[model samples]
Target: MELIEKHEEILERRAELLEQMESRREQLKIQRTKQVEKSEAARHRNITLLQDLQKIEDRLRGRQLPRPHLLALETRYWASVEQSVPAWEHFLLGKGPHPTDGPGQPPRRTKQTPSTAKGSGLPPRPKPRTAR
Candidate 1:
């Protein structure tokens, strides 16, 4: 039950933080004309992640929520629980849908083979055999 309570708390906190963060972002946009939106975006993004963390933390707390009911969830995602908790944990607990497992890295780009186009810098491949 402590897990549920913590989840509730985290969900609540996440909502509040997201709301404030977004509002601040909007304010920054309206207030600052063109100096730098990057900083504001970065700030809001950080807060947004923190909110997510709260949500996740709540999930770790789970329905049991004993002394540290979250331990299970922590073990499940030991390295990741601290990430913005709310949104993350919410998803973790949800039934509708969830993100897929980790994606492997994209295939590394190899050197492009030389094409027939003029002035191409790539080395040419050996000629292919022609049909008799």
Candidate 2:
């Protein structure tokens, strides 16, 4: 009879140990799930930060570089000026017609000095009166 009671007690102890082990396993599973969720949240935040940084870098690079169309326009303007420099110089030196003058327009005349205008036969201007 004593041997039977001892065997039954051993079985009860085994059952209690199994129950404790199962509870510990369930707690470990909950902790593992929480860790996985936290890791995933951190990964998402890191990806978002990287994307934002890329956008900022792209904007900065865009500001640094000139647009192709504007660069082309500027190059063409300078080339046109270079090509017309000789004509502009001739016109400024009075050796060529004005660049913008139309056909049949009279040539620009030089301003005449008072001594030169005397021979033009115009009446002389009266001198200004002095304050008495």
Candidate with top lDDT is: 2
Where is model 2 more than 4 Å wrong at Cα? 65-132
Encode model 1's per-residue lDDT on 44-131: one tens digit a residue: 9999999999999989877664456577666668556555565456445543233433457443333343443334555556799999
Q: What TM-score do all the candidates reach, one by one?
A: 0.25, 0.48
**Candidate 2 structure, TM-score to reference:** 0.48
Which runs of model 1 end up more than 4 angstroms from their true locations?
34-132
lDDT against the true structure, per candidate, is 0.69, 0.89
Q: Candidate 1 versus the native: TM-score?
A: 0.25
Score residue 94 of candidate 2 by CA lDDT.
58
Backbone collisions counted per model: 19, 0
RMSD of each: 34.8, 14.1
